[model samples]
Target: MARTKIIAGNWKMNKTVAEATSLVEELKKELATFEAAAVVLCPPFTALVSVARLLQSAPRIQLGAQNLHPAPSGAFTGEISAAMLREAGCRFVIVGHSERRRYFGETDAFLREKLLAAVAAGLRPIFCVGEELPDRESGRWPAHLRSQLQGALSGLSVDALSQIVLAYEPVWAIGTGRNATPEQAEEAHALLRKELEALHGATVASKMPIQYGGSVTPRNAGELLAQPDVDGLLVGGASLDAGSFTSIVFAVQ
Candidate 1:
């Protein structure tokens, strides 16, 4: 069975509410009848509600958040809960993005909690995992990726995993004008699928959707998506612009 492609744009730390609205309005116009892939736009936390409001009229497009707190609610100041995100009309939320892991020092144990929270709150999670340049060069990427995957997904049930989309964003490539080659992307994606099969089973792993990120653009999107195990894309900077983002969305066609 083929998985429906997903094109999720992670507008990290960019776009005020007004700018976000304009971008989505442009996206709505271009993707009015577009249904080639499931589309998700993740804006900054401050813009989620406003973006959600705009997305209400465009059901084809879905709203997502860049991050969320693992706890439902608490004294954890400066945190947004999954329940809050759901109430704001977010159908999806990104968890354990590389930046979060790097800048905020989020551990895999903590990411697992966030995944559980997101699912429990009825929001799908786009869980990210990847290795840095040194790891890749030292041939430690396999071990690093395995650790990240096992650490975060160890005890999760297959049912819970079903509600998640896995993303592979090479740390060195993100926002650096570098990206994995189709062959490299395929190798990594295939490994991830194999690992999933080991954790669950062939049936479950085969049905899961895995995405590639890191400096993706219209020029290279088509070739990247052509890889057998590469199911979708997790777009970043290019996604901030309506035209470029739309081009990347339709690149496969």
Candidate 2:
């Protein structure tokens, strides 16, 4: 089963509506005819509506949201719900990002509900899992990664699990200008695939796309994408500019 490459740009916290519109306008032109990989642009909540409108013309590129609350209609102030994101024209939503773990104190148990909500609302989740610098140094990254996958996905139905796209973003490397070598990225992605196989079955696991994130630049995107298990990228800073992001997309070969 050949999984299509999915290159998603997580424009976390940056990009006002105006800035997001400008960037997507450029991306629409550059990626208008690109069909090698699936491109997803995750803008901040504030820009979703505007970006969604802009993307109507660029049908190949999909719209995604940075995060979503589990509850459908919540009293949770400052939280966006899956239904809201869906109505905003988001086909995808990022779940369990490391920043949400570190800053907002999102737990795997909590994220499980988020996954349920996302799928129930017909939104595919870009579920992020990774280790911090200390965990990597202590050689506990494998166990840490396993814990994250199992903790959130243990009891999910095959239908639910099928809607997920996993992203391996080393906490230390994100936004630090340092990236994992292609070998290192492959090792982590392979481990994640193995874990998924155990939790689900080989057929289901093989169909799932596992993406690599963390300081991914156009210069390194090609080598990283060359890894067998590294299906795509969850780009950060490099995705801010349309030119650089387009270059990363064109690196599919």
Candidate 3:
């Protein structure tokens, strides 16, 4: 079975409710022309409820959350639970983003817990896995990525694994005004698929969708999405603007 393409935007701490509403409205208008791929918008926690209300009747576009805590509920003062995200009309949740790992000290153990929570809440988990520049340069990319994949997804069943959407985002490329070369991105994507096959089976791995993230834009979207192993993209900066994000969406085909 072929994997469905998923073009998701990580709004990251940006956009107010009003700004999110306007952006979603414009995106809905532009997305009406393309129906082959799935589009998801992840707004900050502050805007999720409003954005969800705004897109109540929209069919093709979906809502996602940028982060979620592992526990369902607790004294975790600064964190939101997967259940809360679902309540806000979120169908997906991103776990273990590089920034979360770099800034908040999210370890593989913590990510695994969060992934389990997201799965239990019936939310599709888009697990972000990648290697830093120094690791890649030192030829430790494979080991590093393998460690993360193994550690984060060790206890998931084949069915649970199928629900995951893996994203290979190079730490150096994210928000650095630099994008990975098509060849580099394809290589990482392919490697990730192989790791999945080794951990799970060929059947599960073949159906799993692997996306490329990190400075993706309209200018490079087509070439990157055309790669055999690349199912879609986890767009960042380019996705903040409706016009550019829609253009990148069109570029997928």
Residues 56-132 of candidate 1: C-alpha lDDT, one tens digit per residue: 88998999999999988899999999999999999999999999999999999999999999999999999999999
Better of 1 and 3 by TM-score: 1
Per-residue C-alpha lDDT of model 3 across residues 80-127, encoded as one tens digit per residue:
998999999999999999999999999999999999899999999999
Off-target runs (Cα >4 Å) in candidate 1 are none
Query: Model 3: clashing residue pairs?
Result: none
- The C-alpha lDDT values of all candidates are 0.94, 0.95, 0.91
lDDT of 2 by residue, 1-253 (tens): 6899999999999999999999999999999899999999999999999999999999999999999999988689999999999999999999999999999999999999999999999999999999999999999999999999999999999999889999999999999998999999999999999999999989878999999999999999999999999999999999999989999999996
Per-model TM values vs. the true structure: 0.99, 0.99, 0.98
The candidate that achieves the highest lDDT relative to the unseen native structure? 2
Q: Rank the candidates by lDDT, best first.
A: 2, 1, 3
> Which sequence of candidate numbers ranks them by TM-score, best first?
2, 1, 3
- Model 3 Cα RMSD, 1 decimal: 0.9
lDDT of 2 at 39: 96
TM-score quality measure for candidate 1: 0.99
lDDT for model 1, on a 0 to 1 scale? 0.94
